[model samples]
Target: MSQAPVVGVAVFVVKGDKVLLGRRRSSVGHNTYALPGGHLEFGESFEECAAREVKEETGLDIKDIQFITVTNNVFTEAAKQLHVVAVIMRASLVDPEQLPQNVEPEKCDGWDWYDWKNLPQPLFQPLETMLKNGFSPFPAKLN
Candidate 1:
């Protein structure tokens, strides 16, 4: 039997014209500012995964979660193979001032909010696309 695909979740938290981003921990795409997210555990719902990943990676609690897109990522590195089905979501901050708890210190070097119009190109391609498209890729579905 083919194994169930690994599902991942990402959050694009926006306020005004700026969006929240996190720098990756390792060298896979090190020093790059990407959306805050991670893979889901077994039996966890997509919304729960989005909330958990955002908090773990950025120390931010997000609510009013909504789905965006479901895409498959096939990774080919050396002899290892990884298939990731990513679910993107939109959410509002519970409280920005609240210090993120249990953050993986080594995973992310920094976090910043960037203006959607002037995002740094070299480190943020996917984000650039998402913002440029007016966030149309994410449809709002409150559940």
Candidate 2:
């Protein structure tokens, strides 16, 4: 089989002043902090993929989904080189009081909410690039 880039949907599930992130236990970004997202399913909209991945990975529901940005990531450190086109999206939690649960412990250590200005170390490739470019998923406050 030939290597081909895959489209991955990443969600910025925000609550109050924080956004949800998890420490990945998967090979793509092992031990690196990342958003709750996964590969985009066939025929699914970006919003749909975001919602689904959030629920699957974090056991949380999100609403007000909207596209934010995209990034092209190529990882060569792994035994198998990987390339992914990350579709970034932002969404608010459906239940503001609900806490994230690590639904897929095999793939993620656990989920935590962190302020945008102070994220944890060793971010996933896409997220690292996004932050390096000064991209904040939080929407601008309207007066």
Q: What are the TM-scores, per candidate, against the unseen true structure?
A: 0.75, 0.95
Task: State, as a TM-score between 0 and 1, how close model 1 is to the true structure.
Answer: 0.75
Query: What do the candidate models score in CA lDDT, each in turn?
Result: 0.70, 0.91
Tens-digit lDDT string for candidate 1 (59-80): 7888888886665666554244
Off by over 4 Å in 1: 1-5, 77-81, 99-102, 124-143
Where model 2 places Cα greater than 4 Å from the true spot, the runs are none
Minimum summed lDDT over a 10-residue window in model 1 is located at 121-130
Model 2, span 5-100: residue lDDT tens: 999999999887898999999887899999999899989999999999999998899999999898998888998998899999999989998889
Prediction 2 TM-score vs. true: 0.95
